[model samples]
Target: MELELVRLPNGVRIALDPMPGLATAALGVWQRVGARWEPAELNGVAHLFEHMAFKGAGARDARQFAEAIENAGANMNAATGYERTAYYARTVAEQAPFALDLIADILFEPHWAPDDLEKEKGVVAQERGEAFDAPDDRVFEQHQSALYKDQPLGRPILGTEAALKNVSVDTLINFRAMHMTPERVVVSIAGAFDRDAIIDTATRRFGGLKARPDPEREAARPQTGHASETRKLEQTHLVFSWPSPPAGSDQLYAARMLSEIFGGGMSSRLFQEVRETRGLVYAIDSATDTLEDDGRLSVYAGCSAQHAHEVAEVVRGQLELMAAKGPTEAELKRAKAVTRSSMLMGLEAPSARAEARVSQLFLRDKLTDFAELRARMDAVTCGQVQAIAAKALEGPACAAAIGPKAGHGALEAFGAK
Candidate 1:
């Protein structure tokens, strides 16, 4: 794997990882700001800004933006995450430069028309409603809100209906100016391509933009204790979140391994014990989400209203067992192998590689080679995994459950137990 980092005269930084013989190239422009950076009044501005980017730019309107890329036989899309927003394209190796230019134009030249803003407000409002109607989605949102409490990081990415309604053209334009700077952006490319030519084109196009000072971000600290809510639905969706180490910590890897062992796959302990053996529910899993300053380890389950209480106890029991006895040597080996193989398989797609590179650069400030990542996963031992699990599950876990009002007792009992 060859990695080259280039800085344009205007301050845009581009990183290229060239993999020879791959037919398709993945490309992306990632901004440093996301939902967490928005001011209280502009809670959803980052995501709203992402939508406005496709409205129009340069000589291309929204339709033209789509047509121009499809004309080149490329697939393009964008996504907004907690801490970043990314615009991406995957195309034949030769069309990679055009994709990069299109992305740059959209990012720097979006024409935020008042008419479009009005129309988009309705669209985002509908989106907000849709998300709220989905029990699973609302449950996660409620969990994050409960876990982080008053922190900006705890807010929903889709902002409230009132906030989305009030987002004017000027608001989005001001947001663009504050957060969309070359210094905070990263352009990453992967696959068969001329690395130097790609960098040169990106530099020439994006290098003209002036860099702005990085915006201030709120420092996020862990919120201890528990929170719960009751709702009306069929199956209960429960999420248990506990504070964990921030990204780049050695414990982060251990926590990930622990998640895999506990609930990662069909063969994982949670799946086998909860869903397979007990027939407790259709889905059960655990995940570790680590940020720059703080992180969370969550165990999620969807179960019948009647089984909610028992399932929670079983899940906690599994954690307690892990804390006491630790994972066996064989289980640790299998979990590590599973994680390493999954990582290797995911990189086969150029688009995945591009996203991975941009995420690493933006979130962790470190470029990780696949080999090094695999080695790190391989180095996690059973003892370290157990210790991390014990630390993560030691205290009162925050719980959020959404289902029929009848199921509230089960959830409340689970928390109390």
Candidate 2:
């Protein structure tokens, strides 16, 4: 993949990925600041800011902005996550400039009306309620809270109702002014496009803005504990987390290998032992969540409340076994194949390529081409995977469960240091 990068005088970084033989392009503006960067009082301001972006920006009202993008045959949306907030649009290659301009206007010329602000808060409150209403979402939120504890990282991305009430037009404007500065922003586009024209447009739209000093970010430290909420559900939803390598760590590839072997698919240990053999769970899987400075390896399962304890034990046992004996040569080979195949398949889509560029820029402060990313995955040995698995057992585990109380104690028991 040939990725082009250009930096404006104001420190706005632009990355362009030219995918040959494609007629459409995917593009986004990514800000490094997210839910984790919010102050205690402004817990969900980052997300609120994302929603407010579409309410009105530049000369376009909400309806006008929607119409403009649709008139151009483009789909534009935005998302807020724990580590970053992204505004993205997909369009035919010829309209890439228009998409970028709209995103730039969202960033630099947002207008949050008083009525809009109040209405958005109500919308976000509903969003929050819908999220917690799902058992899986509730369990993961509990798991994050258990792991991150009293920090902003632990808080829900949808600010609490009380906190949502505190958000005003000034809140969105100040957040944009402070965290959406040139240095903290990255504009990336991928797929067939006029590279020179896109770069010229970016220089015109994002240039001239002054850079600001990056705000202080609180370093994340995972805490160990267990939390649970009882609900009238037939199945218990459980989540388990252990400390893992950070996004920029050398051990990151190894952690990925460990997750794949542990519970990545039907062939993985958790699925085979906990689901196929024992029928302890309807589903079980493990994955890694890595942030700039820290990360966690999480395992999740849904099962009868009576089997929750057994499922948790079996999951822990699989990790211990992997740590003790390491993965077989066949397991290692399969993991590498799965990891590489997934990456290669994803490259066919412009959106995937755009996301990869944004992720590398924010996580590592530089572009790591696909070759290097695959090489890192390929270089991980069985011993390295084992070491990462062993390291997971060294920390206090974080656990969360939703459903009946019968299974809740199992999480507490398993989570105890």
Candidate 3:
């Protein structure tokens, strides 16, 4: 990977990954702000800001923004996450200028009209409804809320209807002014491209923006335990979350390795034991989330209400066994292969590569190339994996469940609410 990092005079960090021979490239404008950066009263503004950005910018209306990008043979989208919000596009390398211009316009010259704001609130209301329409998705929100309580991080990214109604045009404008500074953002591009040409285009487009101080984000310390929402559903959905290390910690990768071995695929321990052998669940998996200051190792399962407790028991047993005995050499090797293969396969896509590079710049303040990352992955001993499992699962576990009212008793017996 040919890589270059340039800090423009305006404080924007620009990273270029010029992959040779590929015809297309991906670029992203990543702001070092998201739900985590919002205050209590402003819970959903970051996500609301994302929706409004697409409504219009400078000389372009919403339709013009969409039409221009389509005309340029590209697609553009944005997402708001716990620690970062990003806007991205992937297209022929020659379309970099057009893509960057549209992105820059939205970020730097957004138009937050009153009509658009009210219309957007309704749009987000519908979006939030769709998200909650799925029991599993709704349960995860409750689970996440139970983990990181009384903070911006715990709230849903799409703020509640009450919060959305409270957001005004001035709020979005002020948010853009405060958090979306050049210094707190990164512009990254990857795939077949001329590094200097792209850099010049970025400078010309994003050069004049002034830098603002990055907000002081309150750290997220999870308040663990149980929370359950009673709902009428055929399959009970449950999530168990335990504390883990932060994004930049050395233990972060170990937690990931441990998580994958525990429940990553059909071959994983949870899948085989809980799903294949006993047939307790249709879907069961474990994953980890690493935020700027904290993280979670969680398991999710969708099971028949009558047997949800059995699924949790099996899940608990797998964690206990791994924490006590650690993964076997075979398990470790297979997990490494699975993780490494997944990484390599994802890097084949320009969009994935661009997002990874930009994320590294935004989060780590630097990027770890594949070889170095692989070396670290290879160096994680089985003992280290076991140790991480023990430490991560040692804390109080937070669980949230959505199912028939009758199954609440079963969940309580399993130490869930």
Ranking by TM-score: 2, 3, 1
lDDT string for model 2 (1-417, tens) is 478778788888888888889999999999888999888888899988898889778999989999999999999999999889999999998999999999989988887798988888889989988998999988999888878899989999987887777788887777777886888889999998888888888888888778778888889978878888998899999999888998889999899989999999989989999989998899889999999888889999999999998888888888889989999989999999999999998888899999888888777778778989899999999999999989999986899999998888668557543
Question: Which ten residues in a row are the worst by lDDT in model 3?
Answer: 408-417
- By descending lDDT, how would the candidates be arranged? 2, 3, 1
Best by TM-score: 2
lDDT per residue as tens, model 3, 1-417:
578788899888888887787999899888888888877787888999998878878799989878889999999999998778889998888898778888989987888889989998998899999998988899888877877788787899988887777789888878888886778878899887767777887898878778766688877778756778788788788888777777778877788889899999999999999989999889999998888778888898988888877777778778889999999999889989998998898778788888888767766788778788788888888899889888866776788888886655545655654
**Model 2 TM-score?**
0.98
lDDT of 1 at 249: 78
C-alpha RMSD in Å of predicted model 1 compared with the true structure: 1.9
Candidate 2 clashes: the total is: 0
- Ten-residue segment with the worst summed lDDT in candidate 2? 408-417
lDDT per model vs. reference: 0.81, 0.88, 0.83
C-alpha RMSD by candidate, in order: 1.9, 1.2, 1.5
Q: Please, what are the lDDT tens digits per residue for candidate 1 over residues 1-417?
A: 588777777767788888777888888888878888977777888888887878878889889988999999998888887788889888998899988888888877887899898788778889889987988788888878876778788898978766776688888878888887887889899888778679778877777777767888888755553445567666888887666677767677788888889888888889999998999998889998877787877888998888888888888788889988899888888888888887877777777787788767766666888888788788889999888878877654677788865555554554632
lDDT score, candidate 1: 0.81
